[model samples]
Structure formats: C-alpha cells, structure tokens
Target chain A: MTKKKLIYIILFLAPFAFIFLSLFVGRYPLSVPEVARILWGKLIFSAWGLQDISTTIVWDIRLPRAILGALVGGSLAVSGAAFQGLFRNPLVSSGILGVSSGAGFGAALAILLFNTTSYIYIFAFCFGGMAVLFSFLIGKIYNTTPTIMLVLGGVIVSSVFSALISFAKYVADPYNQLPAITFWLMGSLASARYQDIMVAGVPMLLGIAGLIAVRWRINILSMGDREAHTLGLNTALSKGIVVICATLATAGAVCVSGIIGWVGLVIPHIGRMLVGNDNKILIPTSLALGACFLILVDNLGRVISGSEIPLGILTALVGGPFFVYLLKKTKGGGW
Target chain B: MPLVEVSNAGFGYNGRAIFKNINLEVREGEVFCIVGPNGCGKTTFLDCLLGLLKLDQGDILLGGRNIKTIRPPDVAKVLAYVPQSHQKTFPYTVMEIVLMGRASYTGIFSSPSPADISIAEEALAIVGLQEYRNRPYTQLSGGEGQLVMIARALAQKTPVIIMDEPTAHLDFKHELTVLETMVQLVRNTGKSVIMATHFPNHAFYFENNDVPTSVALMDKLTFSVIGRPGEVLSEKNLKSLYRINARVVSYQLDHNTEVKQIIPISTLYSKESERVN
Candidate 1:
C-alpha cells in the first residue's frame, strides 16, 4: 500500500516537474536563477540585469505552451481511458466517437471558406460536438444504446466526416488554404496561447475534472450492461455521463491542438500497466502521466529540428514502437 | 411471508408469448431449484424475476412489493444474481470484482468504502477464495470464476440469490463443490437460493434438508409443476419433460440414509422417429 502511495505521489508531481523544466529550455534558453527570478513575479531586473526578452520568453511564450500541452494531453488521456472502459475494448481511444475527424473536417472547411484562423477553433469545436451527437442519435436507433451500436455509430460518423475532410482538401487553394489545412490536420502545439486556454482549455479542464470525479464507476461500466445492471447500476445514466465527458474533452482538445492522436491511445495503456485497470486510480494517473509525457515530447519537438516537428508526428513516432514492445512483452495481457 | 413471489408471470419478444400463467413463491431460508430442457424459458423466467426483462402479463414481488415499483438499487438490496459465466476483457483483481457487488450500497460517483471492502473479504472467505483476492479475474479456472461470482453475489448481502446454471461448465468434483457451497449457504446463512439448472439431480441434492426446499419443473412451453423434490421428481415427469426413459432408484445406505439417484436408460427421441435430427 505504501509502495502504491509512493507511485501516486511521483505521478502527481511528474507533470509539475516537467512543466518547470520546460520553462528554462526554450529557444531563448534562460538559466536556472534567471528563470527563477522571472517566476518569482518581480519585473525588476536583478544585479546581473536580466533582459526583458528573457522574462517575456519564459513567462509569455514557454509557460502557456507547456500548460496547454498538459491540458490537451491530460484531456485526451483521461477521455481515452474512460472510453475504453465504457466501450469495453482496450484499443478504443478518445477519437473513437468521431470527434477528431469532425474537428479535422471543420478546420479544413474553415480554411477553404474563410481563409482566416479566428473561426477555425469555433468551427472545429462545433463540428466535433455535432459528430458525437450524430453518433449518439444513430446509437438511439434501437431501444437502448448498446455498446456495439454506439461503436458502429461512431464508425459511420467518423467515415462520413473523414470523407468530407478529403473533399475539402481536394478543392482547397493549392497555395495558401491547402497548406494551412494540411498543417492543422498534422497537429502542432506551437500556436498555444493563454487565449487558447481561455477558450478551448476551459472545456478540457471541465472534462478532466468530471472524469476524475466519476471515474470509480468505470469499473462497473466495463462489466457489460446486463451484469452492471444486475449489480444495481443505472447503466444508461452512467454511460451517458462517460460519453458526454469524453466528447467534451476530445472536442475541446481538438479545438486547440488541431488533430493530435496517439497520446490518447498510448498514454492510458501505459497508465494501465502502471496502476492496473482500476479506473479509480488510473484516471488521475493518466492525467498526470499524460501531462508529463506531452510536455517532454513537445520540448523534444521544439528542439529536434530548426523547424518545429508536429506533435502528432512525434507522439505516433514514439508511441507506436513503444506499444509494439509492450504487446510483445506482455503477450496481450498488459491490462 | 415469501421473500419472492410471481403470479401469472409471462414474457415474450416481438409479441410472441413464451410462457404465461405461472405462479411460484420462494420463502426465506428455502432452496428453490428450477429444472427444464433446452430453450424452455428457464433463463427467461429468471431474467423476468430479476427485473431485467419486463413481464408481459404478470407481476413479481420482492419482499411483498411489486418489483416494478422498486428501483434497481432497492431491488439489489433484496436480491442478487449470478450469471452462468463472464468473459472479462480487462484484468481486474478478484477483490475488485467482488467489491462490485457493493455497488448498490455505494453512491454512484463513489467507490467502495473500507466497510464495503471488509464485506467483500467476508464474502471471499465464504467462497474459500480469501487467499486469491489479489489474483486477476481473467486468469482463474472456470470453477474458480464461478466461485468468485458467487462471492460477488454474497457481497451484495441480499436475502435471495438467483443463479442460472451456476455449475454448467464444471467437472464432477467442481460441480459438487459448488452445489455443496450453495446448500451450505442456505443452511448456515438462512439465505434463499433460486437456481435454474439442467440436472434434476441438482434438485435432488437439496433433498432431506431440514429447511423448506422446492423443485420446479417447467416444460411444454407453459406447464410448470412446483413441489418438494421427492414429490415432483418422478420418472414419469422426467420422461414427459425431457423425453428420457429414466429410473429413480433409492439405495438404503444406512438405517436413516437413503441415496436417491436418477439414471437415464435412453432418450425416447420423440417416441416415433428412428432418425436423429
């Protein structure tokens, strides 16, 4: 029990440590005392006369990016863990409900029509939410929303939105809109700002908090509907809560982070290995571990090349091989 | 008063009647066993009694209240259910699985408390799986899984437990072990067990008990006969129910002990066809 508590302590603190580390290692790298002086909240220059550029770089640029990374990463990971439990499939991730495709299509359409960046977040969030609504309405074609029906609904909605995205891409301006849509679809956290936190990050925080608050029930939800019912669960209500929370998290995340994947798919599996399948603990652990992972990876992305490598590329690059190794080591018994 | 009562109970799908006009009641501290052939609505009947399926033409009462009137959590406090088997995708611990039975007692957004944990531990002790609490549920043998399920049911602390073919996949020794566990549960805890099984001998095992016992035979889609095991389990009834030519042989093992057995000689096979379908 003490060992488990120690693990919880470390996981809880890992993200903060990484975020702190990130504040010092940006393009305009600030030294430890210099960064600490800026963080100490006094604009006054020290005896060494640290430049205003250092303060602006650390406070305005790096802090928001790292915090946004933590929020997006935590949102995706928690929602992914919750969806896996609700759908009763280990391979299920945050985008299984068509949110990413919907958001991707919305971003492409906005790029094609308006040729501006301001409406992109709103369109992406709206369409992402609508896609999940379509999936939910399709699931309601039957008397009750069975997990199988929900999954099929998700598949149908996802394919429709993905085809729409392709259509938008085919007609976009070859020079300007095409590249813009392509980059948004590839996903990067480089555009993260405090305003992004005010807009999309609020929903992300709500989702993470909701999932963590109601996480213990995922254990009962994973036992299948009938068994959970027999065990006295209001399965419909429980499933509704999980679906709503996960959708909010995914849509809000896609709003700011573009179309990042793999973090949602792999972080929860890693969390399961660390904490077992008990969502009660795994949800919070996923939140913390996901924050740490994305910040570190985003820092790597920033420094890996002269031009920024998109986070979607980096996460998949790292996550795919690591998942293969996990599969081979555990022989598909990692959960 | 009976703990569970059903009157004129009927259920069906797509407006097709499966069974109707059934009447039965289970008392406290009694062992109630239902025996039937394949696809004879035994599981359907149990599902209706457990309130999973809505009864089309009748009502079931738990603790003298209509089952429909009681919420699912309230019904859970009065009755528990054990499935024939479960296929687990995630590797939840046995203790975690058993603690799931406390769901009714806990709040929706909360987990099991220390009190709930102790209750689960006691239930594991009842099923003789105390030392296996930390084991993964997916790795256990079939019989052990069934026992773990029973522990989960026991943790609910319900007065009545409903099981559907709790021993269908077990070997001879494991079957007897589960059967003994069920009987002992009734004898010691005074909790009524309502189970449906394919074996008539399973009902016979509940014979010679000091507590009240009921053996019910459901057949011919609508016909059901409930009585004492010795009174209802006759050779003629077995033949009519299962089309089996069987003998009920009683061996006097001692002055006060008589071992009753049902040995099937042949399947009548519709009594007219020489070809097997």
Candidate 2:
C-alpha cells in the first residue's frame, strides 16, 4: 500500500478497534484474546453454552449496537460528502435539504397524531425523504438553480414541517407522546437489535455503493452544470440520481437511529482534510472514517458515565466545537 | 462542402431578441474568424452551435445532419470548444484539467486510459506546456492558463475547434503564440478552426500569411461583410463595420522582412480628412 493509503487505513481502522475493544472492556473488562475467542466461537461454532458473560454481552447487546453505529455513521458521512459535492459547498449537509426536519416531523406525527409505535419511525423517515425529494423536483421543474433556490426551498419546507412538529407536540398527550418524540430526536443506539440493523443496513450499503461507483462523475459535476454538460455528462440526470441515493441512505439511517447530529456534517469534512478533496478517495474514506467516528462516539456515550448519554449529544459535544475551530481556521483561507 | 452550417438561425433570451436571420458556414481545414463589437450575439451564436442554447428558429447542421439528431457525445467527438476564460476554483493540476477532455470517450465508471494520457501529453506539447503539466493550473500565469485551455481543446482530438476570444487574456507575445499554434493545427492536422476576436489586426495577419482563412465582420443584425483578407479589410469596409474611421497601415519587420498590418482607429479618423486634403 502507498504510505498515504496505509496512513488512512490505520487512521480509519484504529478508532474502530478502540471502540470495539472499549465496548467489552468497560465495567466488564474482557481480554482481547477472550473477546476474540468469543467472537470466533459464536461465528464458527454454535457455542451457546460458553462460560463467560463476555460472550452474551458481546454477542447480544454490544455487537448489534456497534453494527448499528457503523451503519448510521457510514450513511451520514457518505450522504454529507455527496451533498457537499452537489452544492459545491463543503458546509452543506443532510440537514440543509430538510431531510432531518422532515424525518423529525414524520416521527413526531406518527407518535403524536397516530399514537404509533417505534415501528412507524421507518415510515416517518421515508415520508420525510419523499417530502424533500418532492420539493427538489418542484424547484427543478420551475428551473430553479440547485445551489441557492433549492437550498432556500428546503429551508422553507423545513420551517413549515417544524411548525407542524411543534403543533403536533402541542396537541399530543404530553405524558405519553411528548417524551417519545423528544427521545427519538435525541437519538440513541441503546434499543438497537439485529433486526434494526437489517432494516437500515440494506439501503445504507446500497446508497454508499452507488455513490462510490459514481464518485468520479460527482467530482466532475462539482465544476458546475455548464462545464459538466459540455463534457458530455447528463448533468441533470446524474444530479437527480445522486440526490436520490443520498436521500435514501440518510432516510434509512434516520428511520432507525432518529436525528443523530454532526456525523453527517462533520465526518466528510474531516475525511476531506485527511485524504484531500478527490471524491474517489473521499467517498470511501468518509464511509470508513464515519463508521469509525460514530462507533467510537457511541461507545463513549455508553461508558462515559453511570448512565448512558444519547449518541446525538455525544457527537454534538465533540463535533460542535471542532467544527467551530475548523471554521475559525478557514475564515481567512477559503475552503 | 461546409463542415458546419447555420441556416437562418435566430436566437433570443427571455423574449428579448438578440439576432435574427443569421447564416454562416465553417469549412474543414480553414480558419474562420468572427469579428463583431461587444454583445453582437457572437458568443450567443457560438453557444447555439454548441447546443448550449436552443435556437428559436432555423437549423444548425453538422456534416449535413441536424444537430438535434446527433447525440451530445457524438457532437463532442466532432467539435471542441474553449471558452474565453475558465474559473479554476478547485486546485486541479494542469494535467488533470486537460485529462477531463477525455470524459466523453471514457466509460462512466472507468478511469482514463493510457491512450487518453498520451493524447493529453501530446496536446500539452502542442501548446508548449509539457513541463507545466504537473503544476497546479490555478497557479499558472494568465498566458499559461490560456494555453492550457487550448491544450484541453486539442486533447479532445476533434476535427473542429471553436474558441471564443482565445487570446482575450494573453499578452501580445502569448497572443501571437496561441494564434500561431492554432494556425499550425489547421495546416498540419487539417482541423477547422473557428474563433471570435475583437482585434481586426489578427484577421489581417492570418490573411496576409496566405493561410486558408475567411473573415466575417458583423455590422448589425443580418448585415455583415465576409470575404478574404484584403477584400474585406479595406478602410471603407472596416469603417462601416466598426462605425469608426480607421486606417489599415502596413509595415515591414526589421529581421524577417515580413509585412505586418495595424488598424489605428482613434487617431486614423482625424488623419483621414487631412490625407484627403
């Protein structure tokens, strides 16, 4: 491997390893060899009768949570990377397109208006994603420039949805539905199961794969629509495909994990800073780094205190200030 | 036969008609120069040829086929264009920007092939920018950037190259260098060259060199003077075309003893009546 490739691999893998080990090590310290043996036994042999509680902890609880963390992280990061390229602005994220607000409104509507269970969260996410997609399509039909008008349309859509969410909160049975809405917005991996992973994993993986396949084209498209079209690329079609893929990926993640903040916005920027702006490298590296960053943050949330903090809080706590610092540094120098 | 033919082409933006009843033909292996004042629809005409703008009336035919029938990729294979200037916002290497010319040929998912690299290198060599290939394009001088744009057009390997004010940003020496390279491309490769420029002197220079060139001077909508060097570059023709009296003066170079021409517009008008007296 090239030195740069090796460095990125190490940087990407080390955090994953640390998070994996930390998951089993805190309050119930299992040796690396022991954890390895437990994982191997569970995989290669049907050894349900293993002696150590380490097997149960790693297999049943932490493993599903870790996988879920990776899925959510990878989805957010890849989506963020694609959006940044689409807008030609590194600051653009999933939230800019009203995906989060739409998802939040969907979830809130399900909980408050319909009094639905967590099972309806996925529906909410899909509805939210579709809302944003519809807005974008309408804007395009009217010949709106994707940069300014599309973003403004998203903001408008998000505000209307936000008011709906507030209205739903007001009408909701405060004791029953309000807490569920709040908890979903805070986001967590505490309730993750293997089934939850299965629900979210398919779309996330598929979206990331599609983005990777078209990453080079995305880079070319970043030059602006006129240049891209002159180069014989169907700029409109390519952009539509990318936006849909990113939306599906993010929607799947938000459905399962609620509105986890910062990973989508910050991970791609971090990936760019680490490996440079070539999307060929940035896409995959963002996926790996995002998975690692979130897994590490989620694990920290698990063990940092007597009680588990929300994954959303942990990421915001870490990514928020770091983002500010990056902003300050890049103030004089344009990113 | 003409390689590109625009018959009675009319275009407008947002219901504002800019030009109407425009007719032009660009033949192969010849340099066609389009000269007009600012905003005479020169760039708009080029845009129409490239299918960047849709024409409200008439047809544009390439190789006797309507442009609408040809796919964008096929059109790209036949015609390459270099804009007046490109905004290099990102930090792409000169080679990387040049390599983007192969986008039409490469597969959607595949990297550029070795043949693409070779073509790009050859283009860079043609523009005298071989050594600067690895340098960041944004860091290059204005002249070098202009050359890089030409190199990109050359890399397309198209039969016809269209440039809108290719030398607009270059100094005098670089302007000459770019024009010389363009003329060489037409002469050696048998590629047709179409360029738009404000400088009438360039058209005179090309014509005086016995190069295969045609000059078209746009005066107003549907009014133009088109002919060979001396036929269309007379003082009366230029005065009518530019709405200013101008003297076309010829001078012999010291070293080469070649005839050079200059169009002095501002001062020549005052001297016209004096010379008449």
Candidate 3:
C-alpha cells in the first residue's frame, strides 16, 4: 500500500486501540486480559459467566462512556469541518449556528422549570434545532447573500440564547438547581448511559452519514456561492442540507454531552494537517482524530484528580495549548 | 452558427439598469474579449451568459436552446467558468481542484472516477503544471493559482469557457503565460473563450497572428463596437471609449512574425497641463 494509505490505516486503527485500552483504565482499573476476556465473553456468551462487578464496570460504565465519547467527538468534529467548509472559513465551529448556546439555554431552563435530566435533554435538543431554524429563517429574509446572512443570523440567535441562559441562571435556585445548571453548561459525559447513546445516537449517525455522503460537495461549497452555482450545484438546497445535518449532529451532541468544546474546532485542523483538505478524507480523519482526542482528555479527567473533571474544562485546558503550538508550527499559513 | 448567443440581454437589480441592449455571439473556436472601463458591467454580462443571473429584458441561448430552459448541470456541461482570484479557505491540491471540474458529470454521492482523474491529469499537462499537480493551491503563486483554475476549466471539457479577469492580479510574466495558454487552447482544442479583461491589448494578443479573435468595446452599459480585433480596436474608438491618447501599433521583429502592441504616447491630461503651463 502507499504511504498515505498506510498512514490512514494506522490512524484509523489507533483509535480502536485507544478505546480498548481505555476500557481497562478507570477508578475500577480492570486488567487488560480480564477486560478483553469479558468483552469476548459478552460478545460470544452473552455475559453469563463474566464477573458481576467487572461486567458492570466494563459493559455498563466505561463502554457506554467510551461509545458516547466517540459518537460526540466524531459528530462535533465532522460537523465542525462541514460548517467550516460551508461557511468557507476555517475559524468556524459546529457551535457557530447557535446550537451550543441554544442547548445551554434549554438545559438551564429545564433545570429551573422541571429539574430533571430527561427534560434537559429533550428541551436542549428541541431548542438546539429551533436555533438553527431561526438562523435559517433570518438568512432567508435577505435572500441575496445566504452564507453571510446565516453567519450574522447565527451571531444574533447565539446572543439572544446566551442572554436567556444568563437569565435562567439568575432565576435558578442558587444552592440546589444553580450548581446543576452550571455543571451541565460546563459539560460532562459523566452521565453517559446506554439509553443516552441510543437516544442521541440515531441523529448523530444520520448526520454523520449524511455529511460523509456529501462531504465532497463541501469542497465545492467552500469555493463560494457564485462558483458553486457556476459548477451546477444547487447552492441553496445543498447548503440547507449541510446546515440541517450539521445542526442535527451538533444538537444531538450538545444535548447529551452538555457543552463540550474545542474537539470540534481543534480536531479538524489536526486532521487537515495529517491529511490534506479533501473533505472526502478530511471528514473521516476528523472523526477518528476527534474520537481519540476526546477519549484521551476524558481519560485524563478520570485519573488526574480525586474527582472527575468536566470534559469541557479539560478539553479547553488541552486544546488551547495544543492549538497555540499548532499555530506556531504552521506559521498561520497551513490552511 | 454561434456556440453561445446573448440577444438583447439586459440585467439590473430591482429597478437599476446595470447593462442593457447587449447582443453578442461567441462562435466556436474563437477568443472573444470584452474590454471596458471599471464598472461597465462586463462581469454582469458574463454572469447573465453563465445563467447565474436572469436577464431583465431578453434571453441567452446556448446551442440554439434558451439557457433558461437548460438544466443547470446541462449548462455546466456546455460552459465552464473561471472566477476572479480569491483566498480559498481550505488548501486543496491542484489535482483536486482540477478534479472538481468533473463534479457536474459525477454523481453527487460519488467521487471523481479514474476517467476523471486521467482527464484532470491531462488538463494539468495542458497548462504545463504537471509538476505542480500535487502542490497546495493556496501555496501556489498568483499566476500558478490562475493556471490551476484554467486547468480546472479545461478539465470540464466544455466547448465554451468563460473567464472573469483571468489575468487580473498576475504579474506581467504570468499574464502572458495565461494568455498563451488561452491562445493555445483555442488553436489546438477548438474551444471558445469569452474573457472580461481590463487590457485591450489582450484582445490584440490573438490579432494579426493567424488566430480567430473578436473585441467587444463596452461603454454606458452597451456594446460600442464588436468585430475583428483590428477593426473594433481602432484609435478613434480607443480614444473615445477610454479617453486616452493611445495607438494600436504592429511591430515586426522577424521575417515571418509580427506582434500588435498598444502604445500610450501621452495621457489626455498631458495636453491640458501643457496648455496650463
């Protein structure tokens, strides 16, 4: 095989290795052979002879967390890449369409009004979708420049939702619900369960698959609207589809993960560095690298302290320094 | 018959008329250059021809069919466009950019096939950029980048290619390089070219040189003159349209070769300053 193909193979396999290795790492700290044996047994013999505590730790806790980490990270990164290309700006992230703030507001409002986890997830998903809808509607109002208008509309919607989140924080019970709301906004996968995965997994999978199918088109869209039209692309419908898919994936990720940041923004650049910016390869590369990065950060959060550090804080802590290093290395002309 | 026809095409936004009463025909295997001062709507007219903008008054026809009736993909199959230089957000390779020209022919869910890849390689070869095929488009010089775009148009394999300021931001060397490539494409491949340019001399590049070319001098939102480069780019028309004191002169440097050169002897304001003195 060619060197690039070999590199891609290694990149793809490295994540699975990390995921497997991570299953053995945690507060419980199961041995590798035991973890493997249990996984094999569960897959083959249906967890009948596996030890109870090991099974619970392996199957119930770490597996779901790892799976959710992979899904959320992959979704965020792919969507970030998609949005960056759609807007033709490398600085854009999946959150640019107001999904994160809208979801944050939804969670905060849920905490103040209902004080339940399911309500938070449901409200977060609904309002996250609503935010992008509003952004699209606002973009359509002008009808002349869709990309610029969508970006402006996103900024407007994001600000309004950010204000609403602040208002919700202001009215929240300081001692009881306030901390919960704050923690959710800070973002964590600590509560990741199989149910959460099943719930958010469908949309995430759909969005990711949609992006992959149309990933090549993202390259065309990045050429700007006039070029895309001249190339015979239906600019409006294609952009709308990309927006919907990316927003769905972003909303799904935020609803489950709370507000994890940086994975979407940083991972795609890393992917671009590894493989050039053919979205066909870049999208998948982003998925793999994002999964690995978030899992590594999450693993650090689990082991580096007495308590579990939030995924959002740890990602920023790591992503911020790494991005600076990347900037320095590339001299700001890498793209 | 003309490969593309723009008949009485007028375009404007809302109620403002950008350009009107535009009648033009681009025949097969010819280089048609549009020359006008800035803001004379050269690009607007090109956009109308590309079907990117609907004409306000009349119609554009490609292959004798109304362009408005042709599907966008069919229009793309017939015509390829090269826009002005702009910063690309992603650093796609030269080959990748060229391969994107086949997107109209490829299924949306599919990528460029081996056939497409070969076509792209052939295009890069045509532009003499085979060595730069793997290079990042963003890392290329302005001239190289413009050539990559031309290679992209060539890969589209269309009969007609439209360019908006193909040599706008290039250095003099690159400008001539692109012009030679344009001339070569027409001479060798029998392709039609419609280019909007700031330089009237570009129209003269293919003039008196055994090449088919036409010049369209635009002024006040309409064509002032359209014919052979030598016929349309007369001293009187150049003086009136550009308000410059210039001459279109031919220089014979060799026994069998001649070149047309636009020499500016003086500016219109020079005589005014002399009178003031």
Alpha-carbon lDDT of model 3: 0.88
Which wins on TM-score, candidate 1 or candidate 3? 3
True contacts kept of each: 0.66, 0.23, 0.62
Candidate 3 lDDT, tens digit per residue, A1-335? 49999989988897787788789888887887888888999999983775689998998889899889988999999999999999999889999989999999999988898988999999999999999888878888876657999999999999999999999888888999989989999888899999999999988989999898899989988999888888878788789789989988899999999999888888888888778789989999998888888888888999999999999999999989988887787765455
Residue B229 error for model 3, in Å? 1.3
**Across residues A1-335, which tens digit of lDDT does each residue of candidate 1 receive?**
99999999999999999989999776776789988878875455445444588877887889999999999899999999999999999889999989999999998988888866668998999999999999999998997999999999999999999999999989988899888999999888888788988898878988888888789889988999888888998888989989988989989989888988988888888888777888998999999988888898899889978989888899888778887887777765534
Task: Indicate the DockQ of the complex predicted as candidate 2.
Answer: 0.39
Residue pairs in clash, model 2: none
Cα RMSD to the true fold for all candidates = 2.7, 3.4, 2.0
Per-residue lDDT of model 1, residues B1-277, tens digit only: 8899998888888988788888888998898988989999998988888878899998898878999999889888888999977878899999999999999999977889999999999999999999999988988988999999999999999999999999988999889889888988998999999999998888777785444778889886664688988888998898889888788888887888777778877788655323422
- Candidate with the larger DockQ of 2 and 3: 3
lDDT of 3 at A1: 43
Off by over 4 Å in 2: A8-19, A25-27, A47-52, A114-118, A143-148, A320-335, B208-210, B254-264, B267-277
Top TM-score hit = 3
Poorly placed runs, candidate 3 (over 4 Å): A47-51, A326-333, B267-269, B272-277
In candidate 1, position B159 carries an lDDT of: 96
Instruction: Give the docking tier of candidate 3.
Output: medium
How close is every model to the real structure, measured as TM-score? 0.96, 0.89, 0.96
Q: Please list the C-alpha lDDT of all candidates, in the order they appear.
A: 0.88, 0.79, 0.88
